[model samples]
Target: MDDMSENAKSEQYQEKTGRESNPIGVAAVILLLCICFLIDARVGFGALIGAAAGFFAWSLLKDNGTRKEENADDRVAFLDTTVLQHNFPLPQNMPIPYAVLDIRGHILMYNEKFAKEFPNMELILPVVEQLKKAGIGKHAVVVVEEKHYDAMLNQCEVVEENGAVGNVLNMTLVDISKQYELEERLDRNETVIGMLFLDNYEDVMDSLAEDRQPLLSAIVDRKLTQFAADANGVMRKLQMDRYILLLSKGDLETLKEKKFDIMNTIREINVGEHIPVTMSMGVGIGGGSLEDAMQSAKAALDLALGRGGDQVLIKEGEKYLFYGAKAGEVGRNGRIRARVKADALWELMGASSSIMVMGHRNGDLDSLGSSMGICAIARAMGKKCRIVMNEVSTGIKCISEQMAQDEYYQTAFMKEKDALKEMDDKTLVIVVDTHRTSMVEGPSVLEAAKKIVVFDHHRKSAQDFIEQAVLLYHEPYASSTSELITEMIQHIGKRIKLRSIEADALLAGITVDTKNFAVKTGAITFESAGFLRRNGADSIRVRMLFQNDIDSYKAKATAVRDAELYLGSMALSVCPANRENSTLTAAQAADDLMNVTGVKASFVCCKVDDVVYVSARSFGDVNVQRIMEKLGGGGHFTVSGAQLKDCSAEEAKERVRSAIDEYLKEETT
Candidate 1:
């Protein structure tokens, strides 16, 4: 092996050769191989090849090193890479850019193509840094001077004359710039299908004057026409409330750059008390076929509606991008959908041997009440069902006490293990209050049961949702899952007696989620409450269910007292740990902080065990849901919560503040 290290102790290497004398090194290596051939010594040739490969083995693999020199403890170890090329020679006249690198990623040798492609040695540093960070691969993308190359990195081993061994990297780059350009051209021509639905159209029209109806319809179409024109796309009205859109992938990207401000433009249209019409757009791109794109658009539209409309949702491959959900929903789903869901739930329950109802962990009033409401449905259907409860929280203590006193309820509840043991393929699992797969108390039952049903009022989480449910009833406009369940009982179309305790529990669930009917309440919310009241739901009893003990109350007061006002309108607090009801306490503290004048929103964080819980509340001005969503949480526009793991209480508080900052920044942007 020729000694070509940048820091060779030999006086001949005092100045870098800059490839001026590389041909001489190549010639010397060739002469050695020829001399070995002339001697007709096959054993000697094999030994020489093994020694040359072993030397390279040491140079490239001295130790694992990082691109960031500070993070790498291994000192740079360089060896002659000429011996490596002798063992694995590249074609001298090849048009590809080829080079050899030492263990420290210093380019020791390169061909003419390599010099032409990377005129400056610094240009190759990014490629080397990327390769080191991601590890060497068969084909790696390396971009130099805005040109794309498919690079191949191979390791070579060699042994030096002094018995020292090292490993080096042999790299070859193939220009793929034209291929990428052609792909970009095709993407610019690719068709993307989109659906635009007029959210709250029926309600807005009902409130509009008859004389302005035609003008309002015409204005809506005119605005959409302009929107389509700006993007070089076309739209067709499919119904009074639905429109089909055709756009190119390039056009979609243009809209994305502006965050689809068309949603805001459409909302600003004013027409005789019928102005500010909300629109939801769903775009489907990167589909294999036009039909696939259409199906994807339909699914995206459903997701956008489930998220409360006034937004645009794009589905590309398996990923989703959202924009413009600043406005709240003004309409709840009609009763027809509820009736259809009720019928479907009954059929599924009849098909299963037993049913298991579950809710989120650390059962709250909303979760407990919703599970009991599911039990009421199962009882009406004449099916055996049990509520899965891992532990009780302070919010459900009153209803839990009542449950224990009932003889029929003795076997109605089971722990997670017992539930899993009794569960089988014939069991139908129904989850309430939460749709995220990780939040449920009995996770094993979800996988073991043959069929699963989900009933939730929270906006669907973009990630970690229950995708395996056979039937999912998600209504973001409803006050709580208990409210949805209450509606289901009335429409189940079966005569069954709902015990007073169950009624009280359902009322408590609704009360907690709605904050005693102060926020997130709608016509259906009050209607559901009215139905529960007729079934013997005592308002005084529901109030008692939410009454916290002295310890929890003290924690809430301390958190509120120490709350810091953020950016003038928001409050941030850190609650003391109350394990039995820390989440409940945090939520209460946030709600109490919202009572302060000028405080539009509040966030309360508490550390319970290893998990840091955060509860957020807003008084219609600030959308706490979007802020919490930034921290991997989802809820209504006025109420949301998140839990963080592997972080201290101070860290959690900082994260909440950062999320709030991001939310405010998004507003100004």
Candidate 2:
């Protein structure tokens, strides 16, 4: 093993010297071995070993000499070179820009290409800091001279002869401006799906003269075709009153810039009819695929139709944008759907073990009346049912007391807490009057119930709807939820009878919501009232229910007396602060102001329990729903109310005025 180690060392020494094994050394060793063999054979072996040891020692000396020579050359190479001389060299003619930055992101050196691209180090300082934060072997995109570049950063060490090292970052930037532009162009050209449905098409056609019908249809088609052509889109007629549209995102942007004037253009076309034609459009963009885009378009179209048509709804991912929601919902031809919904409700009730009916918080006459009507239906269906209510307004206190005296209604009422305790999987919850979960009497009840149903007359909220509803009966054209319930009771059967007081309560609800059947009272509304009348609902009794106490009367009078007029046709009234029954007083004041000639809209603001409430009423020309929505409340186009928590009456009034101003501004624009 020792001989092999010596031989390996000798070979390494020869390699370092850049020379072959010495022939003179080998000849001396061979001659010594020959002399030992001639002198004595036994002693010759020992002499050979000694000679080999001496040759190994001589090879070690030669290896040391070669290493010393190399070290001397390395020292001489650095003797004339400074640390900066070794570090500072620029690739002046390189196409790719490059830079060197110290650990603190201060630029030490840069190539000419980098200097030309970013003449000021200040502009590149942020990029350098970002690259330092990203550490080494990572790329960052940065803009220079209005062009994009992908910069790769690398950390390197500069070693000196003294064994000291300094750290620096080397950045190489490659231009990516053209590639980014290409990607943007492709994105803009991606396809978007849209659906268009003619609003009130059947009604318009029925009203038009037969001879002019075809001409009007042709005109509409030609205009729609022209509209699509102008946007470089494709449109195909899907039905007599519906169209499917496919357009690029770029074309959609152009239409957006035009503010979708096709809606106005179609409305301007007249065919010897009092009602002009209108259309609703729903567009979907930024979906993952064509099928996904089409599904989004379908959802958007459903929203548009549900919002009374003559509008546009655009769906992009989870968000939505709306346009042209100025028109009121068109009256339907009949109440056929109400009968269908009534039968469905009856079936659902029969299958359930018990039913619980609820309404919005601070249960008003309308909400209470609707809840009672549904309870009456549940009783007729032979299902156990209870009305869930924890509080009653002062205005309905007398009626509630009267109902509590009756044997049938003695055990019919339950609080929200009690109702939740008794609930089971077979329990069905019928929510009435209000569809928003925030306004419900008890959201927990709605959340815990396995089967849910909704009956509401208010316009659907764009957000915050009853997502768990299995059956939704929402009719924006109806005057009141009580009216809807009355219709449903009639369809249930003649045998399912409402008590005289129940009838009166339902009739009072319709009267209050419709302002004594003077506003938003359609033929169906009156028919529903007639059904309640036949069941022994007396108008005198209903009127008696609305008769306010002395203090309420005085509060209402004061609110009317303090009326302020604005916008030439609107009246704003504010009730006294900290008054009893302030909500009812404000509503009465608003109704009274609406009676004044030339007062197209009326708003009454009042403070109640740390919250300011505004009761809004309009006379067809103004959309109170839009105004109220601006204040975070929603109802019908002509009647709506809002509650402002922790606000003064004066602040509430100002907010109402501001909402009115904004609404009018939007209308004009």
Candidate 3:
């Protein structure tokens, strides 16, 4: 029995050491086991005896002092591993998932908790590799079996006793599923407020037969209510033409992904009315209070209206994101708004001690002509005013030359710096054609003036939108800012008649912006033009302002000659850098490409210095305004341009193509 116990112990030691015995050692062990079994007459005792003999033989021949050496080495290794794990900030034995890996992502050791917590190696390996690339001491959130974990990684160098060094990474994971659940719940419950305005509400109501008004109202109500119910929200009618709605942020996200089909759905409403009903909605979220959110929605609604009132806008403090298509030139809320703005502008001019008017950078005819019209208004009022003219662009070169021939214009224009010096808090700054401070002839002048007035016909740019306007008259429906100014001059103050030359400038502004009244012209556009003509605007003189010089005409022709059709519909070309009239050349080239057999849109790029200027033109078949907006520019749907800094002509062409492709993809989807 004692020998049997010894044999069992020896067999266990041999298994732990993992050594093979020699052939003689095996034979001796068998003989010894047989003798022991015969003497004891016990089979169990004999088996133990053989195993013990084999272990003794293996220890003596295979490794001298093999039992103590192997056991000592194992103890040292075990102690070292335990000490290494203990030195970590997070203990491996803690109630957490822990793993150690070499820099090559080879698993060195892992706790039982890690294997149990992350049973799927498929999920861990990929995340670990990403985290490794993210560098050491990085934290990332990953999911395993639908449970979220906040994983942390650390690295160190491990030097073995043989003087070999290797990089080691330590990964620790903590369960964050509960925290994520709470966050998701909060996010799903956040409030989203939307303000809806019925675009062309009066036009629709007035056009409908008296008996159909009630039916139309009911249909609109049903559609809005259904939309609210689908989103698990509340809808309330604020006025006959305005509404407010409440929804959760999560639901708003879904609507954004779908591009707010409700706008299109509303546009489909036709109940005996010539004009289809359309809704302009503004959404606000993440505002701390209901009133704040409502305010944001109101601001967004203003942006939607300013951008032509057929889209949805989400106000983000200084920036905004828009969705839905632009409305046609309906002029739904035109006469009344224009009259009110004119009255307010007259009041502001009357109150201010001095006034200064300016146009956009490199002022085109619409910009410069509108500024001159405002200057005329100020001059008639006998208020001190000057037009800020930085440089003579090709679009306004003819008008400038005409004005230079007259002595009254010699002191009429001032440099931006001189204008800034004379500006004051009470100086009313009137900005025409463009509302962006960055696009203005002088941003400092706009920023310094206390009372600012904006008169623009272009869509409000999303970047650098001028704020704190004492009086603003923005009409996207107008063909040009010149059109708006011309209409205001007729009824605003006293009977202040404009000179024929000044009328020529204003008419030329409208002529260029409307492309000789060939695009974006409305009933009101013609009325404004007729008013300009009656005021002595010479058509022969205005046409001369658009005639390109010989070199400019040649450059434009070269651009048109090199036109390449993109996507079978868009014509793209590059005009070589011409220091003189580059913008004019690019624009004329884009306009000429519109004459192509199947072209729907055209883009012309001209690189000058470090800036690549792109002029875009479309034929209402494509929304070139939106495409230009993607490239950080904004304009009318049929005409727009963008500038790319430090970009090659080829790069600008690629960007325009990409923008067009993306727009087409979105429309198709």
Candidate 4:
């Protein structure tokens, strides 16, 4: 049947089904329409009607065609999806290695192959981006983007059907969590490193003038930043002057290697005003964990500071490593603050009756002056105070003689046997200008006193007598012990009757410590000096106290003339004289020699009896404390000293030379 015949037949079938007729009736209607259109031209109109009737009769054919098209679309979709699923071209029965998931990461399908490979695996998509966002990206073996399906899906063949473009997305899942865990375990087993925040950064920077603080801070920050960068670690300023660094085990060795440069680097930063800024770095390596490393670093840092700043000290397994600090200068502070410590100190001291005041061996002006000042206060409190001395060096003879002339300021030069007899539970011992228990003039005095109070301006030491002292007033930044004592007297009252000789002694101490106001004299230093001046400390009288005997003056002049220059900055003077206090004389000569055209630092080595003593001074461009520390001594950056026992003066001089050479080598690069 043709088109008109087919439609008429479909129409006929519909009408016949409604009227309860069979296929014979439908065929008759189809024949009638076909005959009408074929017989006459006018009957073509009837053929049109017949065609419409045939169209209606054949509606099932149209439905069948629609169904065919729908089936084709479904087949095409299935083929596209299959291509993606089977992108790897593995055997038909091979298990897929990854779960098929939708865009939302939910699993849509899992092949038998995938099930076999990851039987217990969750159906999560386990994509790279998802892992990275969750901070577990380190375990990812491969990263695939949705757009790079052709590459990520193993470059499976493309199938073109109809006019649609489709992509294959085959993802492989690799479980490397075990590997990551193993690496983490290994890292834990390796050496761990930690850092110190280096407290009082502002205090260090403020040691420079107000206008110069920023410059110094920038210099310091830049060097530290660069060092952190070199270590392949991240360093951040946690606070104003505090920093936190995360370093790997491998990078810690670099820190140890560059230890010398670190000291040199810090000491090189200038503020355009005061001394150069330096740091005391403590490194802890090979700890059980990062926390232990941090604890060790803290301990090492305290050691450095206690020894005095401007050196690198490392603590590992109870062993210590010290580096840099060839200049041997302990920092000086002329500033003085009132001795009115926390109320707790007064209460602690008030609990005692008889008090003893003492100082380091061969007490200097500052030590004696501070003790005298304390004695006056003790007298005001109606307490019996005795100044203890091992032996007078004659350097402080005039002041000591005058104080002795006044019966109230009594001296206890009796042997230790006698001093111990007088000591009792009510005795309060005040140690001035020294912290080390071994350095005190009379160790028994400290051992005998029931309660000990320590006031010192020097840097701390490992041998500090902390447990013996109930109260400690140690300020490494202060200028002199005399200045601190002077401040305490002011708080007690001006009516404490400070004698002219006492005032002179205090001023001389300040002058000697500050090197005639050349370095380390802060605002508080001059203020203290001014206070002493007002209390009748005549400049001429103070100057008279510093004037040595004629022979001693000549020795000082000769020592300066024989000084040798090192690194265009440091001057070294070796004194072989048997002068009883040649160490002090040589140090004074070095200080005087610093005024020479290009001298930046001065070191004086002198032999006293069997011990070779070295005294160092600096313009803040060098770290002398580190040098002294290497010889088992410690002090501040601007002034430091060390004693070389059982070594000849020549051997000591050679050691000094070697230290200077090493220091110069570090600075050059």
Give the per-residue lDDT digits (tens) of candidate 3, residues 21-90: 6799668767877777777767758578668786668656655566567667644553354544544334
Q: Compute the lDDT for candidate 1.
A: 0.83
- CA lDDT, every prediction? 0.83, 0.84, 0.83, 0.67
Give model 3's TM-score versus the native structure: 0.83
Counted clashes in each candidate structure = 20, 0, 0, 29
Among all candidates shown, the one with the greatest TM-score? 3
Candidate 4 error regions (>4 Å): 1-246, 257-281, 285-294, 304-313, 317-344, 412-415, 447-450, 462-468, 491-497, 566-570, 665-669
Query: Residue 318: error of model 1 in Å?
Result: 2.6
lDDT of 4 by residue, 224-301 (tens): 888778878777775665665667666766666666476566666666655555666677766667788778877777
lDDT of 4: 0.67
Ranking by lDDT: 2, 1, 3, 4
Q: Which stretches of candidate 1 lie over 4 Å from their true place?
A: 1-139, 151-173, 350-352, 492-494
TM per candidate comes to 0.80, 0.77, 0.83, 0.60
* Cα misplacement distance, residue 60 of candidate 1 (Å): 36
1-669 per-residue lDDT for model 1 (tens digits): 355553364444323222123688657777877777778789558757975896557434442222234222222233434454554455667799988887778887888888888889988888887877767765788788889988877787755443445677878889999998999899898999999999888778888988988888899999998999999999899999899999899988899889998888888888777647899988888769999999889878888888888888999877888888887765745799898998898889889988999999877888888888888877877887899887876667777888999886778989889988887778889999898988889887777878899999887776788988999999888889998888888897547578899999999899988888998889889998999999999999888877888988888899999999878888989999745788888898998998899998998999988989889988767888889989888788889888899998889989988998888887776
Once superposed on the true structure, which residue ranges of model 3 sit more than 4 Å away at CA? 1-93, 101-106, 133-138, 154-170, 316-320
lDDT of 3: 0.83
